[model samples]
Target: YNKYFSLGISVADEMFGLLFFVLMAHTAYGDVSYSFLEEMKRGSVIGNIAKDLVLDVNRLSSRKARIDTEGNRKRYCDINLNTGELTVAERIDREEICEKKSSCVINQELVLENPLGLHRVIFNIEDINDNSPQFKQSVIKFEIRESALKGSRYLLDEAHDADISMNAVQSYMLQENEHFLLRVLTRTNGRTYGELVLNKELDREQQKEVTLILTAVDGGTPPRSGTVAIHVTVLDANDNAPLILPSCLIPGCVHIGYNITITATDEGSPPLSSTKNIHLTVADVNDNPPVFQEQSYRAHVQENNKPGSSICSVSATDPDWRQNGTVV
Candidate 1:
């Protein structure tokens, strides 16, 4: 049966171009597998299915040889009757089809009529380095006390890649610096993550903040990577005691009856302080004398004024409120 089919196909190929076919199938003709890179262009030739399955190319037109994806709504591939070649009907993006699966394979069936036959065809969609590792956030922040111990580990946001296997994120790199370093860890589930380790103690007064870059990289050739900025804020810790100076000068206006409070604080994380209150009361001193309204006092009386006769009155003024400025 195979020999006769091949002979007919050869003659048809020499005459009219092999064109068009229908499918009839109940008999299984075994499975055929082909490997292809992901993201193949539409209309790209995959393989000659008729040749692989030892089918009659001539019978394709009369018997109707076609492809079926088990009632799939989107057909990814098609069979060309003229050349018996299987080709991509639409673009095949492995990431869209299989997501994070370790391996991606598309199953299809090649069917033909006449005697009726079914051949299983498998397409192994290999991964390509088309995706870069990505973090959920652009920046990560941390707060540590100035007294924080060295070798402290801070978990970081894990990077994700759409592509799997060698194309997925495999390692991490932290920008070189004295205060921190990067540590890559693998989970029991075969997944990887990153940690930031503190290599030195922080001093809030000397250096209050630090920034570093963390990068996630894949193992693909000409690797791709994503980065996130790490910001660390060093909090203060109580480390110094309050000190009192021998003497201090008071500022601003002060009166004899005024009260004042003095506070002293230390430059510590949580500062220490002391306070003192003062009150004052003293006797007043006379500083001004009374003044007459006219520099020289002049009074006039009638030519033969009698004793105790009334004369022009003399007046004096005092500026002080108390007896210190009184005129007698």
Candidate 2:
């Protein structure tokens, strides 16, 4: 029986095009594991295997099964010359290599010269508790309305860890706050996030501001953790009724001259309402009366003056303006 695995790569470029394919497989097992995060030297033994039924361990076939890394990834391991055991070729940083991926494997091609056969081996890099969780920012700020009801959930930024599996971020903890609690939401992709839930109503006049501490811990011996500072500000709510300003000042009587604009304001978050246009009307008060410029007027005209002859005109002034200032 023959067992075979194939890898196909298609590349397209404006000036060039290339298609690549390679095949690799193990004689018995398909995958293997190695402890990562440790300082691996250039020739540290990782595993042992036989080549062409030569398991004597004296005359090994390491040269026949030379190690070859794929693409641009630096070679991390190679087989020993006399022992025929896989050895570390270069230092491997699991965090930098895998990042957010769950399945982290190293691909290598082992080519034998005598029979001219190529075999691929997948080395699964097992994670260790080497990295701590980290948040994108040092401080997070949340602005909420004072009228927000209880049981409201606010989404929060998630913490990230370079490690994977049990070594990755496991849980989140929020510092005890009287009006707020913390919740962790797990997604379909096995990702977790932090959420701040309101336990009671917020009052801007009573407590305008609050601070919380969020911590993320990983599942490891002597677990490592990270923290983020959370600051929440309660916004004002519309609670006061509209207030009309005390009347406008008048010099003489501006009612007939110009229109007065009175303002109505409130003590809410938006202090002013849309109804800022006020129609100020001057009420009619029967008080001051218009008086003529002179108490008496004497007009001297020639005898037998023309029917439509000109005569002296009288003018009057009133202290009150607008409707009260009207004089005939």
Candidate 3:
């Protein structure tokens, strides 16, 4: 009875083993597997890193799974968040691969914007405090009429501080000098001026050009400074007097028909001050009475001489010549 019971148990065990074998073979036909374990391992690595960094694993998985499940019509790749690296999972067409080999992958290293590529991806690098403010031009120029009134604002060329806002411009400063003084001139047009004031009225005769040193300081703590030389020129003004020549002395009236010369000069600016030869004309006055060599000359007395006959010879001398001389 014991032997028969043992034989029945062995047969039952053999039947159960055959049924298990058939079930496994039927399931194998539907499982089209190609290293799913390796893919799962790769997926877990990315998923774990994303979890640690609090990134979206679902989004990354969706992007990767799209190509994994469907053979890369859209050409997808997997990124390992843990390593900050990319792995190409499926390639849509042969053109997607550089070498056309099974392992050739698309590179997605973060790079600057490129104009030539057809498709691109960008990752922005957050800025860190890096650069100091700098001026575009070290020197700038402006022209102002030297005749410009005192306290009149003459703005210098505005400087550009290239540093980011709040770091770019500090208050503008003028160097200590006798001739130049600087001030800030703000306007409604969004333009600010580094106004330069002339300490004294410019005199062209004294100095044609005036130079001043100007500086720009950024508002940054321990401010940065830039300096430029400013040149201002004084223009000429026609404000001078005409010069007069000294009077000439001549002997008075002894010689008849004597000529004397007089001149005038100017002390004014050029083109106005140059001397021109001008003759001085003097009119004779009756103050100088003409004198005769002798008061009268003896002549033959004839009782019957014509009433108008010359009785005596007379002569006189005049001190002046031409229109100035007179005979009476």
Candidate 4:
């Protein structure tokens, strides 16, 4: 009787062990999405890092789990095996990789053990306006002719921004100036360039040099900007004629011992003024009246002197030329 009872107990224990094995729970693989800033430091925790992978490790003591990137392309991130924590392995720069594209996606896979599973992670690297607009040169220089017509256009070297999307360079601004305007152009590579267009004419005589400031701005929340100083020099042109200045002396009339001076001014590159000195040599026209040496001439005459005899000689002179001064 004792042998038969022990056999029945062993059979019951075996049957129950088989039933528990048939009812064992099976774990399923998990999938999830996560977001992180572009430049997260290494060793930082990324919570909810596929927490469903192992479910409850405390309750499922038999479950073992781990996460790793696909192959050797773990350029941006690393994952914790025991804690299911994700961390940055290397700094990620969206602009450097995206190149102004609309989206940046980093495709990776994390593997889990115990209840074997495979999971895919899609990391969307977002952009931030961390870069300021930059110019190739700090100072721009140009030499233009003063007579250049209005509506002339001058192409300039383009500016660059290290960020993409709205953080990239959008437009340009020129300082308030009466002589020029600003224009923007886009290239096939999505690079925006700038130009200086002449709206008003220039005059070298009036203004020799012009200093302007060009600013490039981006379309960020707090827009970033950069500036370049533009220096333009206007060249001289011979557009004016010389001018004669009136002298104090009158023309076409002269007298002895008189002087005359002539002057002229030029509007050349280096303006100049010239003067000429002249001495007048008078020519007589018999305009002077004859006069005696004394204010009143006293002629001594003997009473009843001979009628044909000249009592005293009277003298007179004329200022006309030899032929015209002949007196009768």
Candidate 5:
């Protein structure tokens, strides 16, 4: 028995052009599925099988049935006189996807049957980025330690001004470090830094200091420049000791506890002159024999029967400077 279903229609340029009729059924056991009896085929006609039935002329049958002939075995559906239902011979939606103009289907309108159902199908498309990275500010500056080695990583004060996707921001470039020895360290948020690490350590005696410049770039379709200047100041290490100058300028004139002025200076940056203004204290040494104030003194100790008893103590003082003045 044929069952009635819904219809779908679409129009273009203010005229109805596309129409689809879908048919679904409840079998004898009450299970809902589509029927495959009648479909769109050539020469198949959708007319009332029972002519004397009391149904409306145009409402009796939907022309969605199968054409049933040997050479013209196209599918078409006939109008149900009792139920006003359409019967399809093949799958409804797959048969009616025509891209041409003025194309029509006889019984293939079942494609739009479940257009609003949750089981409807759809397609999605995606887009990509193609723009290169640039710098927000033309120039940026940061400090670098002169002691930093070539190829050592120095963080940038500015970051790239583009979205961080492979198509948008491809890779990074450096204007300097041409030896291909420089390396880059990137942060999680796309910030980048370069290293000028040392191929060999520097000697303070040969070259006291130096300076360097740095720049950054990104890899895109058309690359962008993000250049920055790095100012590095190499400081001197205290490798040289203080040297005493004009050793013989004073001759045996120092007295006990008298502070003498001896000059000592280091041959380094700033103030290469001798450290003459600095005073050096001189203490009297044991050059002369120790003279007793009272010639000699006598001490008496009583004999003790018990052990661990103190007998007598004496002390002396020397008027010298540094470690020499104190005795252990």
Candidate 6:
């Protein structure tokens, strides 16, 4: 009698186990996706997973429904079996997870036991403006020649933002100045950079150095910005010619064949000068008249001498040069 009773109990247990296996095998699978803003606080409700997956809310606890992140060390989310709502288990930082990727997604599964059921749950993480643009260096220095052309371009270091898409550095601004302007450029990889363009020519004589502020801005609401000081030292160029001024000098005596040197200097910071040698020559003028040694000429000649014969000659002197001193 005891052996027969034990056999009946074993058959009943096997039949119940077979029925449970058949019920688990008929479980349905589902796929659903939802979006949520990143940096949500812990315990924040994402959505009612039971309603989205078309599951009976009353049976959530009975079926032992839970969220499975596929062996992820950090459980980002959890399912409230009593309320049928999915809540955040840990704060999700989009930058920490996706790291510059345009799209951020956390793949999870809604798992149920007893009569096992599986549902794929995808969570799309959206970005927020929590980061500001930052430059590697606080001050950037440049040495530009004063002779640079108006359209010359100089590449600048781009600002870095941890946030992706619109929250990243979007544009650059240059302070109002006469010599330089700002131009924004895009890269093939969808990153943006800045270019300092020479909108006006530079003159080291006028301005030896220039200080400008460069600002990088993000496309967030009430956008955040970063600033870098640009210290540009205008290098001197030989663009200016030397200027010579006219002047008169009163000297006691000046020789007819004197050499004079003239120098011209420019208005550069380190002034430049040029020298020229000039040979002076006196010109003939009618300012002096012939005069005798004794103020009167004395000539002794024979009355019967020939017209071209020799006679006692009278000489005169003039303190003039060249043709003006000729005593003919």
Candidate 1 lDDT by residue in tens digits, 1-328: 2322465476686432222131212444467999998778989998998898787787788778888775464677899888899898998888998998888888887766676667777899999999999999989999988888999999999999998877889999999998998889998877799888889988888998999999999999989999999999999887545554535444333465677677888776467787777564444456557888988867766798889987877778786546866788
Candidate 6 structure quality by residue, lDDT tens digits, 81-197: 777888989989999999999999888877776666767788999999999999999989999999899999999989999998889999999999988989999999888999999
TM per prediction? 0.67, 0.58, 0.39, 0.62, 0.29, 0.68
Clashes of each: 6, 1, 9, 0, 38, 0
Off by over 4 Å in 1: 1-26, 243-328
Score residue 296 of candidate 5 by CA lDDT: 61
- Report how far off residue 9 is in candidate 3 (Å): 59
The 10-residue segment with the lowest total lDDT in model 1: 16-25
Q: Residue 43's C-alpha lDDT in candidate 5?
A: 30
Better of 1 and 3 by TM-score: 1
The candidate that wins on TM-score is 6
Instruction: Estimate, for each residue in 31-147, the C-alpha lDDT of model 3 and write its tens digit.
Output: 211111112222332223233333354454333311122222242345553343334444223222222122333322211111111112221111112234334666555555556
Candidate 1's clash total is 6
- Per-model root-mean-square deviation over C-alphas: 12.9, 16.4, 21.4, 13.7, 21.3, 11.4
Candidate 3 vs candidate 4, lDDT winner: 4
- Which model, 1 or 5, shows the larger TM-score? 1
Winning model by lDDT: 6
Instruction: For candidate 2, list the clashing residue pairs, or say none.
Output: 24-120
- Candidate number with the higher TM-score (4 or 5): 4
TM-score pick, better of 2 and 3: 2
Runs in model 3 with CA error above 4 Å? 1-138, 142-145, 187-192, 242-328
The residue pairs that clash in candidate 4, if any, are none
